[model samples]
Target: MVRLEKDLLGEREVPATVYYGIHTMRALENFPLTEYKVSPVLIKAIALIKKTAAEVNFELGYLTKEKGQAIAQAADEILNGQWQDQFVVDALQGGAGTSTNMNVNEVLANRAIELLGGQKGNYSLVHPLNDVNMHQSTNDVYPTALRIAAIWLLKPLSEGCAALQEALQAKEAAFAGVIKVGRTEMQDAVPIMLGQEFSAYAGAIARDRWRLHKVEERLRQAALGGTAIGTGINANKKYIFMVNDRVRQYAGIGLARAENMIDVIQNADVFVEVSGLLKALAVNLGKISHDLRLLSSGPRAGLRELRLPERQAGSSIMPGKVNPIIPEAVNQTAFHIMASDMAITMAAQSGQLELNAFMPLIAHHLLGSLKILTNAVHILDEFCVQGLTADEEHCRNLLENSQVSVTALVPHIGYDLASKVARRASEENITIRAAALALAVLPAEKLDAILDPRAMTRPGIAGTPK
Candidate 1:
């Protein structure tokens, strides 16, 4: 290990292993790994983080071209793919992203140092803090990274919504002409096409996509140069624009500085708002999942208009049983996202003056919720919706068995007679069609035409023969 002098700030002495690509080791030694690591989104957000810091460092007259090229090259590699597989770090520990920010600097600097034909730990040639970090502090960098990470992570959310929309569209088209019972309070009330239910589900996902897109607009505002407080202080004026420009370029995004540093640095309500959007998305997912679970309950005893993919054995004792496991996963993810939103709200409220020290928890829970919901959406799309089946016979049987068909007799035999028919059908366990025939509520041919599920599915038709 090459020996290095202590920092001019008179902080702890630099370790040699940190200079040699041992980012994890240095992170553990310098900042406690704790339970939470950095978020993958934040890790990816480093391109913006480094771009902002590098320009500022260069403007501060501390960075040389040779070191700059090295850092830039390493950053490019990270942006491309080299470090994509290592983001499973716990997100529950560390304050101010000390461990995470330093990990990026150390790893990138080591890789850049190697590219410069210099041995690792040879700050004599390139220094992670002095050259790579320059005029930046973890305070400014962490929040900036979080914003970029949230933007990066929104991709999956968008795609998940699209997939759900497609699923609903497909189901809508497939069941367009298939009629079924529409229920209110679990009792038959009217008629609607199975396609109408799927269309509603599809419409819900489209609305969710819109909400997420709106939330992302607010999330794009980041505090890049607030630097330890609401003031840029020692940072150069042009450095902010340059870093933000480069970060946007690298991230393929439209990131911008906060309009007001005082408000941005002091308040984390934007994060809370974004978290709430995620919770809203989770609620949508839970609603759709619950609907699917209800629609696919059983082949024999329950409403079986639809069928989910049989992922695992649903019952321990029953044979050939299948359950809506994908929907269940979606349900759990929704709960987690809601809880994460609460954490974000609390953290945003916990700020004292200009900084929220509880940001670590906010980032941790929000990122976790994003990842969990992302995977859940994908799983539901791939392993469940893609494989769903419709029970044609069961749907027809339910429609035929419902007593709501007695309403067709209202205009023919009058309301009082229709009520008698419905009550008699319910009491005798006979279908409304059978009771109508026994009571001579309407001619058999007229009853058959008017009580048809397809005829009832049309609007403005009160189950009367036309």
Candidate 2:
């Protein structure tokens, strides 16, 4: 069945059963970009804003008690996960998310009217703009809702980071005693405990989680009372003062009103700052993944100091081949996140005058990066970091063969003799210990004690070289 709905652009027949109205219908027609619909979390954030506005308006005697009650009930239903499919507009629409804000207002209005025993589109009794959107503009409400949605979304990403950090720390403890040759510029530089490398990864993830948690401080300050352009034109002074408090109560988040509404409305630097933190996380994850790939490069020919879990058959034609698919997937996810950060940077800079017209793109990229990184962190923990196994024998062998092990003998035999020992090891293709003993650089017992890889990983002057 079809019902006619009119707007300034004219009337269109919308599906009778849908809660969304003509504004949403026009947006659907205008932005046929993809099958991507608005985020359900974003929709719920908008509904919470609408419900709070209704309560404030009713308390100020601008709305009837019955109208406000019905609107609040309808918003509660939306928050409890109903009528999600009725939000049909694309997420990437233009006009700074007016289409999205209007979509929420219309849906809440129609549903509230139905609850009040009136048919949908009966705006005379329970109007979408007149009652539900009282004192609200897309400029104020949309950015406010986006902030709430981002705070809501960051919880999962923070949890994912914590999980990944725990997994890496477990690996760190598991490999604490295994000594390996540490490389600089692809050459052996010194001996180090394998645990130290994993500890570094864990530290990076811990910092990322801390940054994610700190970001809420900036996101909590919103431009909700700014009306159309921070002037609070048509809204009541009481409503402006009380709305954010009510919103914080309804949403159960620490949302604060912006002290300077004009600056909040005109600038998107907070989002840029948040995206920069996300990019730093992506860079860390990418570096960790790359290091994992190199550490697990080969079983026979490359630096196979660690064994990654064999996830699947790695080749279409070759047999008995297992690849580091999990780390590879994480690498790709980080790349996507970095690119999304670039998009967010451009969108933030595109703001002009009183408001940014590029909010839809900003919303799309920011939320998308968060979602992907959350999943990436979870999979990296489950498929890669948790199941890592260090090749202890390989680590010992590499440490023994490394010419850089002569670095330990520098204090006893002097750097000049240590340099000659290293040169002889490389020239004669022998172990550093063998070259030192052949050159009589130190006594055999003294050389063994000084060149001990495990002792080298720690402190204390190599036991005075026996």
Model 1 poorest 10 in a row by lDDT? 2-11
> How accurate locally is residue 281 in candidate 1, as Cα lDDT from 0 to 100?
82
lDDT of each: 0.75, 0.90
Model 2, residue pairs in steric clash: none
- Candidate 1 at residue 284, lDDT? 85
lDDT accuracy of residue 418 in candidate 2: 88
| Model 1 CA deviation exceeding 4 Å by range | 1-36, 55-61, 83-90, 117-119, 122-124, 312-319, 407-418, 437-449, 463-466
Candidate 2 — which residues are off by over 4 angstroms? 412-416, 459-466
Query: How much lDDT does candidate 1 score?
Result: 0.75
* Candidate 2, residue 412: how far the Cα is off, in Å: 4.2
The weakest ten consecutive residues by lDDT in model 2 span: 457-466
Error of 1 at 307 (Å): 2.6
